[model samples]
Target: MRAFFKAFHYAAKGIVHSLRSERNMKFHTIALIFVTIAGLLTGLSITEWMIILILFGGMLSLEMLNTAIERVVDLVTTDHHPLAGQAKDVGSGAVLVFAIISAVIGLIIFLPKWF
Candidate 1:
């Protein structure tokens, strides 16, 4: 009980920190809010919501991972190592891939109704 609560508290703190400290997280969250509203306006069914939620989650999770990777790379090699730079760039590329795929999915899901 106490142990579980402690773990939950730390996890909640990390979530709050991530939401506050990460600009990409902020953008993803704002996008998700607008997408949710659009989903409602477009009259998405529950299944559609499930799919959208999955894609959104994938994008957000990948962004977080990219942030983590970049931070680690910076921490290890703050003096401009070429390999570290490549690592950071690769992580960013992963985030870009996820973001683009998610955007395409969003357009596919939402455009038909609006058009």
Candidate 2:
């Protein structure tokens, strides 16, 4: 239990640090704000709003993961390294996957309404 608490504390600190130093974290925060506002104003039913919320969260979660991978890679390898490059690439691929999934969800939600 103590170990779990310590790990949780460590992760919380890392998240706070990332929010401070990462441009992508700022972008994600701004995006989250906009999405929350839109969801509030759009008069969505509970189910629809839940879907939007999930999609919004999934992107942010993936971004955090990508940030974690990059930070860890940089920590381990200060200079250029092939394995470091692959680690970053995999992290980027995770972001791309989430972004594409979110885009599809957005289209599904907004396209019919717009048309």
- Model 2: lDDT of residue 111: 70
- Give one digit per residue, the lDDT tens place, for model 1 in 1-115: 9998999998778668779999989999999999999998889989889989998878888887888888788788769888998988998899898889889888888888899
Give the deviation of candidate 1 from the true structure as CA RMSD: 1.6
lDDT of 1 at 1: 92
Runs in model 1 lying further than 4 Å from the true structure: 1-5
Candidate 2 local lDDT, 35-109, one digit each (tens): 677667666678878888887777767878888888889888899999999999988898888877877877787
Candidate 2 TM-score over all chains jointly: 0.80
Model 2 Cα shift for residue 95 (angstroms): 0.5
The clash numbers for all candidates, in the given order, read: 0, 0
Alpha carbon lDDT at 70, candidate 1: 82
Q: Give per-model TM-scores.
A: 0.89, 0.80
Model 2 clash pairs?
Answer: none
